[model samples]
Target: MAATARSTTPEDITSPVRELVIPDPSSSVRWHEHDWPHPLARWHYHPEVEVHLIRESSGTVMAGDWAGPFGPGHLSLMGSFLPHNWISHRDDSAVVRNRDAVLQFDQERFFAAAGTLPELEALRPLLEAAARGIEFTGRTAVQGAAAMEAVNGTFGLRRLATVAELLAVLAESPESERRYLDSRGGTYRLDASEAEVFNRALGYITEHLEGRMLVPEVAEAVGLSRDAFSRLFAKATGVGFNRTVTRMRLTEACRLLRGTDLPVSDICYRVGFTNLSNFNRHFRATTGTTPSRYRRIDQL
Candidate 1:
């Protein structure tokens, strides 16, 4: 439970990332759980700014236009309106699980706390720029992870100090190392038609994940050309069509591994992969561990 911050079942929030209330907003420091039975790779946005410290999981962490394989000690700060998701392979025990500690607060609350402080004010731009998403690597991520972990049990001024230190570390992160997820004004609105297209494509992909999925086939299902669908899919979801489909398949693979008693080869075929080698390769690359090892760890 210390991994995820929420107390409710994962079904409560349809979104991949759910909001967890920090008790005493003023002193809210807690871990939330995000063990959804279903895998999520959809594109959605939130109003709160989020800072995530990913521990012991590996996957494609997508935010706006940025996407990358996340490893242990990975950290990211995403501003409001940035759509993102983490897609990981499942453990062999049939449980698709990963733990992340998220700290979220409103922009207004952040500015109000720093309005009078010139030093803090200087970091506002960085925060604003992160409206898309900012991934930290190397020393900054490691240092930030330590600083954030310090806030886990802190209270009163001490907790606030940890939060400030975390933000300061984020502010000082190298701009070159920080990748943005979306370009300015590139956010897409999901209307009925777009939603229909997305849902249809997603449904079809999920249903046939064990087989080859062609862009043109998906496009035809939604009445769009391959090129048009690809562009729209990326624009609307902040990820490409192939990547989205791969993420979906991988997500399901994780679910079966943790929730079912099926063999790894069976799971690979069930998730639409024709070859076990490719599945294993992708699983290891995405989760940073073999399916069997992941299952073993989760079981313990």
Candidate 2:
């Protein structure tokens, strides 16, 4: 259920990308299953707490700043606004059916209800720890995954009970049987109204990774003035726009360096860094090593 870290990118507390999840108005929880290439399978965070189980496929999972491999039975709980994505390695034409089971609920409301139902209080700490993202192991993983699946087949009180059961299983997991993914830090602060704007801006950045990305250009693309975009971007991402772009480029550079035989200079430009010296400097600062050293160590 656990895999080794695939990238040396130091764990950051938050990411700028956000996913707006709208739960059914009738129910407190949203449970569903989807395929590998579904529209929801991307790097984004939401305000709801999520219990996610991977039913199939092997891929690199990026939760916050933690990147690692995951396969079937991979279960994790990510708290509000913690960016996460499962990047499955498959042929472009391949399709994996029902590859993910996900349950998302408003933990704040659950906590409020716990005041009247004292029995629910025991789960408070587990929900708090989930802000850093928790990966269950051994028996916890097995039972949590089962309980998550059970939520899909029930309705009304039965479905709520199943969700509680899943939380209890995860809450009871020993420290040794669970791994916290993100480092201690702040999470993305985004308003629901601005989610679409940020999503469009982030997508544009991803598409143009091979070229220079300007604040005014991206602002125009997202229908915001340059100054307005700058302020909002800093508030939502906890950093300046340029820094975010640099970090993203460095991430892509690391991938190319580790997985391909591309030259370091070529990688610098490919990831939108016009200066090799600047790329090398930033890589060393973020990863604590030079590009050649990182590739050599990772390859071995």
Candidate 3:
């Protein structure tokens, strides 16, 4: 029998459809909250598996050949390489600053941890099921959100505990109404060479944040063309190629502004900006405040 078409509108996605991975620090698991109009707000994919919670708004999720409606407390777990996106119809598309709480982790590492600890051993089934993508509802949605929030406020070893606790809660719930989102079978994985090339490019970006940071230079270093590099970078980092460089520069500037006595103008050039006004404008757009105010606020 033919499958019924998924219900979705045209506004739910973007074109030239590229995939991406979430840029993560070298950690076992990571949690963060981002509202829409943010960098991760795009149609993309990453290697690490993801657990997503919709904290606000009503929307539709386009998950690889499937589309469905969602609202606050909507929860889902997607395996590696499964392309997905969420589009909201709230306020005629105004921005929501804290619309989602997300937890992402390396599947290999998480299962490795699960293998070592008997407590986590039970997660094997759920983890395997997640490879096809799982959506949680009913009681599981509430519990999962609570668990994600716990990790959000925590740091150090305790955060891992919260994540584990979350897994247990999710795994035990019979009424979670867990459903697979990917109508297609399992997803794809980056090959060894792709992983290496992606990592190398990431390293290059990190090390060369100061000056003359161009996408083509990094692409040439990684043996990819400009267009290929741009698409792959957007897929891996969920941002444009040039915007990634700008972000790296301004991030360094933000750190210097808060942690050091360096004058803002001097720090601008240090982080690759040629002019002060441009620096101020980018900083405000990224951090929601000017450099001078950020410095003073951090000092207080």
Candidate 4:
């Protein structure tokens, strides 16, 4: 049977479109709230660092090659040029007001200020990590969202202070409360063809994460020789192809463990691991806890 064609209209969201974000003349950062279905609500990338807060709605949030669920209080930071978007599941005529709160500032300006202010320099590592995008969860998300609201309600120095507070919350988040959103660092420039190839690779990884995945086959499928594909994949994603696959499988396993009642052993094989011991070991190494214990803590 032939697959049904997916139709798209002008309102359809597509990713990585270059966007021009202009801050207000009097403000150093752009802080604004906008409704869903607005012109700016699309998959786009800009040169400014972004702090984003979801005020309402549930949807899939995409950053680079990562896509996952998001809802109210979803807070994240993306460094310059990271492609991102949130697609809310809603009716065609739905209109959601104040669905997103966004703050964008020039990275070079911030870095220049940091060069003079020693205190601001302390956040260097957090800004660096934002190159791959960062998602906050648990208490970090709560605090970050509150800070964003404060930013919304203030102006001048107070707004900037609240922005700093939000960044501090993200920078100090425990590893268990944050997730890096992309394997690909956003610094690498990919032309349209390269971006398409990389997106296809990511799509394949998403679809096959629950099964055995091999590099050679994936390379051939993407129409590159194994060695060439290895170089491009590593350059574009900052990780080896096999390691990326392993990470994705482990991430999926974590989701299942948190959101479903599946037995740990069952989730092990279900996420493409051939052995339960190996699964447990990798999960522990990556997440700093055994799968069963991770679930227990999540439940608590």
- Candidate 4 lDDT over 155-259, as tens digits, reads 788878887897788888898988898876756556656655655676566556567888888888788888988887776556568776787677667667766
Q: On a 0 to 100 scale, what is the lDDT of residue 132 in model 3?
A: 65
User: What is every candidate's alpha-carbon RMSD to the true fold?
Assistant: 8.0, 7.0, 17.2, 6.2
- TM-score of each predicted structure versus truth: 0.62, 0.65, 0.55, 0.67
lDDT of each candidate versus the true structure: 0.65, 0.78, 0.68, 0.76
Candidate 4 ranges with C-alpha deviation above 4 Å: 1-14, 17-27, 31-45, 54-74, 81-100, 110-140, 150-186
Candidate 3: what lDDT?
A: 0.68
The clash tally of candidate 1 reads: 23
For residue 275, model 1's alpha carbon misses the true position, in angstroms, by 16
Give lDDT tens digits, candidate 1, residues 1-300: 111111212222234333234446555434343442333334455666778877664545666645455656878887776766664433334443546667766766667767666576766887788777888877888889888777776778887788889888888888766766655524555554664566566556544667788899888977898888998787666668876677666766665666567778888887677798988998898788998877677578
Candidates in descending lDDT order = 2, 4, 3, 1
Off by over 4 Å in 2: 1-29, 36-47, 54-75, 81-99, 112-119, 132-193, 288-300
Q: Is candidate 1 or 4 superior in TM-score?
A: 4
How high a TM-score does candidate 4 get? 0.67
Better of 1 and 2 by TM-score: 2
Candidate 3: residue 180 lDDT (0-100): 79
How far is 29's C-alpha from truth in model 1 (Å)?
7.3
